[model samples]
Target: MDSPWMKRSRRALELRDGFPRLMAVLNKRKNFQTIPSEVSSST
Candidate 1:
């Protein structure tokens, strides 16, 4: 069986690895939203 500490450490590592990917997705979504709004208001 895996140790308890090992499980927690693995979870933390996974989050750390995924955080940048998550941030990038979020940033792209925000930019996509902003561009549409700016174009609509400027027209």
Candidate 2:
């Protein structure tokens, strides 16, 4: 018999695996937004 808790825990593990990649993409987007302004100011 399949347990609901087991299914939930499996889903949680999948989310944990993917969360870092998601954060990296978000951080890249944040850096992309800031870099242009910094370059413009420096030039």
Candidate 3:
């Protein structure tokens, strides 16, 4: 069985790893939406 401390640390590590990936996805989505709107407005 895993210790509580180990489990907590593992969860924290997962969050640390996942947070950036989540941010990147959100940033990419924002960029995707903005780019199309800008292109449409320009033309």
lDDT (CA) for every model shown?
0.69, 0.68, 0.69
Q: For candidate 2, lDDT tens digit of each residue in 1-43?
A: 7699998888678768877985686578788774445423632
Point out the worst 10-residue segment of candidate 1 by lDDT. Answer: 34-43
TM-score of 2: 0.44
Query: TM-score, each model?
Result: 0.49, 0.44, 0.49
User: Of the pair 1 and 2, which is ahead by TM-score?
Assistant: 1
Write one digit per residue (lDDT tens) for candidate 1, span 5-33: 99888877886887798567668878876
Clashes of each: 0, 0, 0
Provide the global lDDT of candidate 2 against the true structure. Answer: 0.68
- Candidate 1 contains a number of clashing pairs equal to 0
Q: Worst 10-residue stretch by lDDT in candidate 3?
A: 34-43
Q: Which has the higher lDDT value, candidate number 1 or candidate number 2?
A: 1
* Residue 36, candidate 1: C-alpha displacement in angstroms: 23
Which candidate's TM-score is highest?
1
